[model samples]
Target: MNQQLLSQVMASCVNAPDWLMKKRQLAVLLQERFKSTPAAEKIMAAWLANPSLAQLEQSVGEQTNADQVKAAGLHTTGWVNLPLFTAANAYPELLQENLMEKAISWQDSQLNAMHLALLNGGRFIYIPDGTIVKEPIELTVDCSLPNYHNLVIVGAGAQAAIVEHQTATGRQPAYFGTELLLGDGARVDYYQSNRFSAVQNHQAVRAYQAQHSVLNMYLALFDEHDLTTDFYANLDGQGGAAEIKMVTIASGQQVQDVQTQILNHGPHTVGNIVQNGVAKDKAVLNFHAVGKTERGAYGANSQQQSRILTLSDECKGEADPVLLIEENDVNAGHAASIGKVDADDLYYLESRGLSEHDAQVLLTRGFLLPVLNQFPDQKLREKLVDELAQRLEEKHE
Candidate 1:
């Protein structure tokens, strides 16, 4: 263990509670299992020297109450990864004995003193064929830095199904990056949601699916004061299917840039995307859907759709759908629309003895029901709905 690195990380997160400090220590310990390359060392050094911890904590305090985090609940199961760099080689030995492996990569560059970087941490998860998980697996990342880099990788085997959820919280402006890989004949359902109080930044999500695999993703973004987000999806497997959906509500001068890329690399593949955006106050929302069919992707089918509803006169919304086809036998289509609430729909509901507020709520609920109903966890779904309702109330007021 490098005491200097430990001391630096500890000092940078001085305000964090002892429990979180212990968690970081555990994470650092787990880092030892993988062979550290030069790039990994440099990234670790930058992570230790991260300068935005204080600002992130302050921002988190302003946007989210501590009680909410505590109430979110924490559950863990199955084979847990222990810290890698402990005096007891027991953990590392267990990993080696079990034939487990990990991967780490990082990229950093600066132009005219402006920083651009990408950091990725991934664990190779090998589930035996036909393995099934009843409880969802969780990966929580708390980035405390300005100009950040993050990535997560999940691997599954044939006939395997896993549910993974990721959450990011804190202040400090950051650029978040993510990539997911699924194997042949495997299936994965992923859920990710983000909330930012006052961070100015951008984020991207990318995934690659293998033969006969299925990937279903659900994403929700709320409250990113003056921030932008870019999301992407790619399907590379034959007889594979990809379903992507996102819901975003931006207020208070925030700007959302949402992009989706679904590429068909195999025959008989299917891809679809549905995105909804709502903006209030001076916020701006930009939605882009791009579907590409490669030359070899004969008999592939793809469709993309985007919808935006503006609630305030000062708010702005943009929707663009693009399709690229190189195979004559492939089927592809795109649709996009940007508009406000329909006055007739509101009037009809009001005529049924519903108040304006109730009518608006009904409209909003109708817009989000398609995605919300797909959530298997009722508790989590209700929590998300409550959060959305609170944000909507704040926007209307």
Candidate 2:
């Protein structure tokens, strides 16, 4: 960790609440204690070599144009959007939620602390009780500024969809963290898409679902550099449910590590994870899916499926699916695979008047279609499909 920058950010927290300041201090202390853990090792190295706070401040000072925001499939309407810094000030009651408290883990404490201490720009969104949002809420995230955090809350019986688009056009180390709280009976469809070419992205999204609540998460990652993503959902109340679907492409020399986990802490809860990835050239892609049922989570159901397709001999991939069930009444299962495209399928397509490159692209899309079809937004689904096709075409051309 950069002690000089850390000291500067901590010193600048004069305006933060006493509790928040104390939390930041504890986060720093935890960082020092767990810096040597496996999960913290690679993340800390990435941060220590990343750009300084001064560069991020300058980048955040710049404005984002409408064209860039529109390209991410988002608009500036229909959502209650507030700057993350003063969100609690506008709604003083929100301070009672204690955001990020449940999302913290001993494994990633260092990176979590870094985000808490150095967060620069982000948004806060709240959905009230009994409200049903017809249109999806859209937000554009500029990744050039680095550490950006988002806090979203959905009240009891409320239902909504949120789309977050991250855009990075240049070389930078980017961190995007989200903490979502869903009240009882609330349903949320959260979608995130990444358009990064030169940025090394470190992203995390943690959600807590209350009784009878449902959470559906979709992730689309098409990056040309290293990327690390951690998505976790906690079913904290009886009958809560969560499903996570992810599609990604890692080409060139990129390295991508994605982890998805669902923790069943309530009776009759359901959790599922699905992921698909295509790796080409010298890229390396890894997906880890974990489903854990707590001791008293009776009648819980946990399932996961992960698949990876390698398009080159030089490329490497791993699909790891794990299930840990502590309750006898709970059900758990997992499936994982890492393999190359089929030569026979390619030959058949070529015989049907398609080029080899086109055949490979078609097959890859077909492999990912199951998860893609689950996206609730048709326009966002089309956008992801187009992006996937474009990247595949670029690789084959």
The sequence of per-residue lDDT tens digits that candidate 2 reaches over residues 1-397 is: 4466557666756655566666655665666655364544655666667633432221222335433322222224333556665554445457435456656442366677776765665777777787788888786856566667778888899889989887765455667788788999999999998666544667889998899999999998876668888899999999999999998988888888898999999999999998989888888899989999999999999999999999878999998888888899988899899989888888899999998778878888888877888897899999888877787777621
Q: Over all chains combined, what TM-score does candidate 1 have?
A: 0.67
**lDDT per residue (tens digit) for residues 1-397 in model 1:** 3465456457644544454345444444445555653433443444446533332211112323334432222123232221112101222332332211111122211210112111122222333344455666554444444433322333355332333333345444445544455667767777766544334555555666778878787777765555455455566778888888878887777767776778888999999988888776688888878888898999999999898887667989999898999999988888888888888898899999998767766777787767766765676677778867776666433
**Candidate number achieving the greatest lDDT relative to the actual structure:** 2
Give the root-mean-square deviation of each candidate in angstroms.
10.3, 5.4
Q: 388, model 1: CA deviation in Å?
A: 1.7
| Superposition error at 131 for model 2 (Å) | 2.0
Model 1 segments more than 4 A misplaced: 1-130, 141-143, 146-169, 347-359
Enumerate clash totals for all models, in the order shown.
Answer: 4, 0
Which pairs of residues clash in candidate 1, taking residues 3 or more apart in a chain or in different chains? Answer: 29-83, 29-84, 30-83, 30-84
